[model samples]
Target: MSETINTPRQETVTAGISEAKLLGSLKHLFASSFSVLGELMQNARRARASGVTFDFDPDQKTLTVCDDGTGIADFQNLVVLAQSGWDDETMLTENPFGMGLFSVLFACEEVTFRSRGRRLRVSIDAVVEKRAIAVDVDESAPVQGTRIEMRNLAPNLLPAKHEVPSAGIVGLARYEMVEELRAYAQGFAIPVRLNGEDLPRPFAQENIPGEKTDIGFVSVYGIHRAPDRQVVMVNAHAYNVYFLQGLPINGSAVRNGTPCVIVHLDNASFIPKMPDRAHLYDQERAFKRISTSLTELVERYLVDRKAKLTPKEFASRHWTECKVFRRLDLMNDVPWIPASLFFRIGAILESSERMMDRCTALATTAQGDPEAHLLSREDVEQGKFRIWRNTPYAPSASRAAALLLKVMQREEVLALADNLPEGHWLNLCTPDCEGFTFDVHASGCAGKADYHAGDWMSKVTIQLASQAEIVINDPDQRMTPLRCIVEDDWLLLPAGFTERKAFNADLPFGDHEAVCLVIGRGIRWDHPVDALSSYTDENDEYRDDWQENSARLWNALVSGLRGDSIADLVATALNTCTEVVASECHLPHMAVVRTTLAEPGTRVRNAPRMEVVCLQDDAFWESFAASFDSAGDTALKQRLRDAFVATVRPGEIIRTAE
Candidate 1:
């Protein structure tokens, strides 16, 4: 430490330089073999090097770098560079902080420098002595360039065997993201090679997951600019960072993991870097901005790439994203842009006949045809890999889903009824059965038979022979009575069943996932709560959206109630009710409403039956017609009435609450 002179007459004291500490600081910056290469490459680039080459020998555990650049005239300047700062005097070495070449020697056990008919050999001990470095000059003609040979590198300095890439050189512009490198390496004159092959280019984050197959001693030759960079996938695997034609820093130097080699094309332009050139200095927030910009660019690239797709590719991607991703909006946007591009490209992208085929395939998949699997397989064979189709996301995706839903259904659904009172398994809509009972006392309704008299609820009794029964205890939340009925067995299959609310209902509790069963009937209801009107007043100001949604829901319910009273209409009502309940709220509903025709003042008898209503299509009708042929007249009529059902058209598309 320098002592400050308090007295005017006292002379100032200065601290002497610690050579050991000075060299120690620079050594850590180039600890690894790749990091050492990064520092050295910069020095070569600074010398206006037109080309660089790297040679690795596994036998000797040695590395040699030769660069065709202006040669160093004075060998002693290396020692000066080893201890200088970012002053004008140090700038004479063409290095900002003058540590690059010195650190390269620090990382290696032994280093030899050959340039302009001069040779110098350096070791840690020789560098510490400052004068022991061996120098020999033949004075014979030599190449006007520089060559560095390093051996016996520090422990863990070189990449592990598994960490090394299978192909391309480890530390040069050899192999990385190939498509991107080829596009960006056009302007640079420095022809850098690693293991004799060009380096790979950068892939975006999403794409990087797919490139795990190529992970290893990664090297890259070039970088795509912003928008293009955004399109590439992000590789989470360890990677080496290179700036311009040289590596200024590596991801491992700052943090360690399966290191992600992050290369920035013009990082130096906007990113603040440390003086040692080892890392981006205090630029976490800045890096986020770069990441965001790159992400947006990637999105742009995807849109552009999509424009050039064949109809088959477009349809395949659409189906994959939609069926697998369950993103209909995304699917809608994909093909439209590609179609416009097809026309612009003179319709050469795909034939008109192919478009029809793609549409047919897409329609078949949309219609729930298993043959759609074949179409997706064909798509995979054509270069566009689909995750949602043939992969686990395909029908196989249900395996995991089934396992998960089994546990969830047991806990969330069946177990939920455990809280309900015993024998209180029927909904309000189900009439009192001879064997079953209801907790009308707990419902706050035993005192008044007239309570909720006209407004009744439908009770659902699910019977699985081997499993415990599930009953709808409370039919509607607004009603005071806690209704329940227990009844038949249906093993809820995991197929064609979802616990998702397919629509956004404007009603309360509409956002909840619909309780759908696989092998049995799913419950749905629509009963107007005479009391709910008080919650929504005519004078109260409501948004147009709320009013419109309410109007639409009421219309659908009224339309369902007004439909023909046949078995098909009954199935349609049940299906519509379930869909509405899934999207909005579950209310009292049934396939049939049995009402007695007594005098207006007289009491009417109402009996409730919870039964499964199947929207039997023509296929089912035809299949049942033959087997139902040979039977007794009364028995056959009863069987036909129970089994045969007319098909109802699917529910219309509803407007979004969003």
Candidate 2:
């Protein structure tokens, strides 16, 4: 009994398919209903089919696809999932998953395959219920080819009932099906036809000019055409489209300033994902290799072109690519900086030719070459000689200086002021003026400037005129000057001013003009004074309060400058008063006295008051009640009401201010 040993029994088990999983997969197998066309087209191409025809019968509610391919010998292979019934050559060259027919069944209620004197009809309901589909003998079937008919298509696959037939097309057919055929067969190998008309088809590689490499046929688009036929890579659209075996694969092409390059895999080693086969399989490593090869190909072309072309020409052609690829060595003698890094201020000129002409390319601080001219703070401050400036339009001079100097060394500069205090930084650059401070004291603006010298060189504190508003012409105005307004100055312009008031406010202004001193402490020569280039609240959308105050100040300045009376100012104020009554008070009709009451008058000193006419409608009353409730100033609201009811019909409420 002690010597007896119990033997443990072991049975061999293999992985089994789950019925529920298979049915679930059938439901979500194809990404798009249009994928059915692609799957069928793939089958036809892999079978070495010369031509495939698709015919739709509206009366029978069937779509027939007849292909002159090597017909199916064994009907069972069509029913068996993952069992491709193709020759070794087809299997080796194009990986087939044998799951394509399921896409047809999924899209249609019933499917019939007639090939090699045998016919098989499979119902989608039967497949869903896991029922057996039987193949039958058919003497009328095509002897050496396959003919498939899909009947009772899914609702989404049906043709539009009330659609106008396209040009040259004669029957009621799904336009979507036609479009699907066009997209899938555009780069397919075999010719495809619909309703006796040949579908337009072209291999992606054949249409593009590219060289074949070990991985694929690489083609570059968005290339500039030079006079000497040299490579120009500026302003190219990046390629996001990818192809394998003349079929498109889903790949994201990042769009940037770089050149767009398309890749069509010519090598047979590529494998597609199963089922729909719209994307690559677990070929990440293979794709990485392909990308590496593509990089090499582009690099070789650029390197070869660089040697033949001048440095300026090369930089002009492939600056974006060189920066991306870190091949700046090719730009050795190029004396130009990127326009985006510099010239976007005065004019919106983006042309490389214009940028080169208007700007002098100086060496970066890193290069201490004897011939290199490094611009100091004084050079930029003087602004007498034209030089390249950063285009970011940063708000403060310090921030802009930091942003530029972080990338390349440059001098901190200050623009000279037309009118300043005796000891202003702009006025005195003397040795004793190193630590001098200038405080700006003005109505509607306040700022302080401190000057620093020594190791930091010259640090000029920024003095922004927070309340100034003025428009100035941009610096570089070759073709046409780009209009720019200081953020605060723009805010000061009356938003709801009448045409007459706006015209009265339109005074002459420019960069070098004395308008800077009038608006704020002084002008900012470093960058544009737009709100975008300055610091402001991200959440601040509307600044309604600034309108009235800005208009008043602006009128005062304009009046003082012209030595005119307050007529224009009063007109502008009247316009603003009318706007507030109509827009804010929601008065149906409002009028402000435009003429002066004291114009050769006997006793009138000012315009008496504004007038508002109330409508008898309930909507007008509701708005009137809401305006009263929402207005913050009760006294103003009472005054508005007194002014409002002076003119009214029989049903309207009336109140006389007197």
Candidate 3:
């Protein structure tokens, strides 16, 4: 019984498995499978194979990629293919990354692999239940290189049928693949068959049409290896009409989708990575220098030889086409070169002579045009019409005038009173009085003809007068020796109290001439006195009296002073007065003073400390007080006043101080 119970010692093995890790690896596998062609091509390059084959069955939805590369050596490597961390250092002969093979499993349900040196064949199947499963390998018989046959292809994972058509599957007759492969193999060439057809060669030995026979040297800015990395310049015609190779890494034509000036190192390694996209314009600068130099050389050589050159000839002679440009229509997408430099070069070649002639003609015309001098003077004096220094005229007015002239097809003329001499004199004529008086001579029209009798003229004038009793009794309107005066051919009113009277005095006496007169209504001569008296009486203890006075001033600005026609001056005074008060008093008192200047309907409530102040029967003052409580500080109250004045309503009593 004791002899029957014998048992061997057991060994326990622990393996670490992470769900997140597995999911991530699976996602990478799926994404990598979509780019399987790149991987296989990489492997083919390492194997020194001329081309790689892609087999697809649309009906069955299957893709089989086979490369004539030095495949797996034995059953051991084949079994561990799905396993992570497979040693692939020795396979560095071509493919840099060994993970590409696993990416295939993501696209297909089953994968069969046969190596050249090995006699054993292995198959890998991805199990829906178990992450991945593989069959036991028979090392007794293995194939030479690697042959990967994948089945149950996910249609979505495959490249478009048109991108890698079945027709291109024939042997190495395709030139695109041949050119791509040539860069990898150096001088060695191999044939690739796709769908049983050979690929064709992409380029021939014929010289590019219209290329200049004589060699031309173009100076290029070299790379500056100090401070920061950047492209200096590239010689455009240096490698005219040459072909270049590119690696399809990460599914991009340029490195990281960046445009770069491809530079060939003396050691034969073309820098694969390009400058950042933000710095792509730097390449254009180099292109410009090269293109200019090359074009100059070509133009000099081809002088008097235009009749012998064709369109194609001209392109090849002056412009250089890079290999990247030929392989892909990248020039169309690259905004810097093809659109900028290439177009610039072409334009120069086509119009250089004509452009010079045009420039010469322009210079001569500038010296001959008499109106040019007048126009320049008008430009300098256009703003002189402003009433005050630094006053800005409406930009829209100028724009409208320019548009009108353009639409009417009239010669552009500056807005000058003297441009029409006859009209200028007529404008100065007194309509009601037969006598003619000139106030100011039109400086612009001094050299022109003078007004004569028996000439029919249309004249219009406007004069504004202050109707306020104070302004009427001020002696200027009544006792002035001269009511109107003419100086330098311009009519001026010496005693006009308001803009309306001044404007009306020159109006056509009998006939309406679109005249406008604004009678100064509520303007006052003693505004300061009235202001001080209003706050001095019962409201003197309110402490907001200054605010009320300030508000009145502000109202005077916006509403126009009762006895004055100049609203602009009143506004200026209000703004200046506020600053004066602010500089002289404490902030709270300043706030109270400023609030007084607010227009009617403007409100200023007391701060939190004064919220207990009850509202009176006057809704205006009550509303004003309410606003103060809501207003956090005096600055806020002033801002509220400014905002209210912008939209003040007529007849609304705005209480400035509460």
Candidate 4:
């Protein structure tokens, strides 16, 4: 049983206000006129206003705000403006600062208020001069609510327009923002119109496109560290925040640094707000709270949610939420969140109907190389998976494909090897030789990271369990022993990883089971990943003849490693000959393999796959068997010797002359 500790009750303290001081603060308080205008509109809404209108007569250089609501009660007492703090003793929860009316009085040259049968006008000169505010009683054509107008708005104050304009205060309107506003209106049970157009709802199950498409209203309180549709996510960024009337005041792109045009909405009210009412103050406090406070809550919520929804229903609901950008901070911050979630995220990115359509369209216009199969049978049937070899988004497309492969959940994903690193990109390539083949391509260079193939295998099992072939691309320059063992349809490739390699490769790759071991250069390809792009060499030329010959040597090396005879390893020593001849001619695989043969940045296991070379200690074999007991590498030395012997051809001779 857990003991409960009691602490003394504390009262919430608010800062005392001063009228003159606050009036001077408006210069920084409202960066754009929209913020000030938004506050005034919110004030109207708080008073249960049925309608609000902003009219600007440029000819008269005056702006007028009209609202159908309870009228302002006091204008004579300046102390009324000084008592600006929100009063929460009642059920009321609207304006946090009740000084919006005074903020206007201090900002404008002259202010006029007409309501019921009374008219009050106040001039800043009169207030500063300590004169009585002018008031008049008029019974003719009495108005029930309030009408406040001002002449000569402060600089940058909004000049009211009839319709939402493209350049002025309304320019800030975005599709997401409009949507957020619509949702807020429904939640608060109010109707809001921007320049006469009804704010269409965002964040709703259904959407109706409006006459204006740019209004994006979002008051995104929080993002899910793990996105599950069954339970609601408690947003920490919303910890101390709410947007003013739930409108997105700050501009943020949908994915933060990504290319997606939408936004990741944040709250200014939930967090500490800057004096300018611009953005969250103390943003780090919010982020840290997300880590420490909400992790347990989020996990509990997920557990409860999973219990309620079927797998397909859960997946389908989650898929709809893929349009929102995944939060960047929470990925590393929360420990309970499993990396397997990224795989699901990747699926959402790649499997989107719009993206698939784009790929298909690109594939139609471009002819695929004869040796390479660009589209799979399933791809064609589904009208998706087009290979646009020349589009500007090829690199991004590859990332999407990589993400899709990363999160793939299926029974057909078979393990190829043990003790390899995380972050090796795998794809279900439809090569000419097979229906759909599994091919692995490792990105980023492995410097000095641990390799645990078994751990990765567990994750792979959870994500993709396969009954198909897996081909590992064993790059050449590594010092670590890369040996492949045939297990059913698995083509395993051992890698050259060590304890102290130069550390440059840095993007989070690795789960608890396996950390990424990077090698080779981290080359960034910009265009759509073509077969040729994957095989770029010194002169950057791609040729079929060279690829065919390299493939022959590659197949021979695999064959040699599997053979029981040491002679097979010895025979394949000419594999180095294939590499040399290939590299001298700028063969792409040769250039890649050379990284293995070259002097490593750090010392390593140094086992040479006569298939790919690195200097090995002569005594390495003596202790090699003891190094990997659980990894099942007892036969590795025999395999390496056999593969080396297999490198030499029938015409080759080795003789000692005495």
Best by TM-score: 2
lDDT of 4: 0.37
40 Cα displacement, candidate 3 (Å): 1.9
Ranking by TM-score: 2, 4, 1, 3
lDDT for each residue of candidate 3 in 425-501, tens digit (9 for 90 to 100): 21222121112121211112111111111101112122233321111111222111212211211111222223223
Give the best candidate by lDDT.
Answer: 2
Residues 1-658, candidate 2: write the lDDT tens digits: 3697889898889998896578657858677777787777777877778888888755566789989888888888877777889899877777777888888888888899999898999976677676788889999889877999999877677656556655456443346666666666665667888878887654445555667788777666533212233333322323345667666676332223323556667537788776666778776776677767765665776787778876555655665666555465555445432322232222111122332353334334444432223223354345532332222222122222222211111222111111222432322321111121111222454333222211112222223344422222222331122122333221212112222121112222221111122243222332212211112135744343443343344444433343344556556666756454434344444333232234345554643223333344445555665677774555655555556665432234477798
Candidate 2 deviation (Cα RMSD): 16.9
Which regions of candidate 2 deviate over 4 angstroms? Answer: 1-13, 18-25, 124-139, 159-174, 222-239, 251-261, 266-269, 282-295, 324-326, 335-392, 395-658
Task: Let me know the TM-score candidate 4 reaches against the reference structure.
Answer: 0.40
Query: How displaced is residue 581 in candidate 1, in Å?
Result: 42
Clash number for candidate 4: 62
lDDT of each: 0.38, 0.51, 0.32, 0.37
Off by over 4 Å in 1: 1-16, 24-26, 58-61, 81-96, 132-136, 151-189, 193-245, 248-264, 270-279, 295-658
Better of 2 and 3 by TM-score: 2
Which stretches in model 4 have alpha-carbon errors above 4 Å?
A: 1-28, 58-60, 77-81, 85-95, 140-143, 154-189, 193-245, 249-276, 280-283, 286-301, 309-413, 416-658
Which has the higher TM-score value, candidate number 1 or candidate number 4? 4
Query: Which of candidates 1 and 3 reaches a greater TM-score?
Result: 1
Error of 2 at 582 (Å): 18
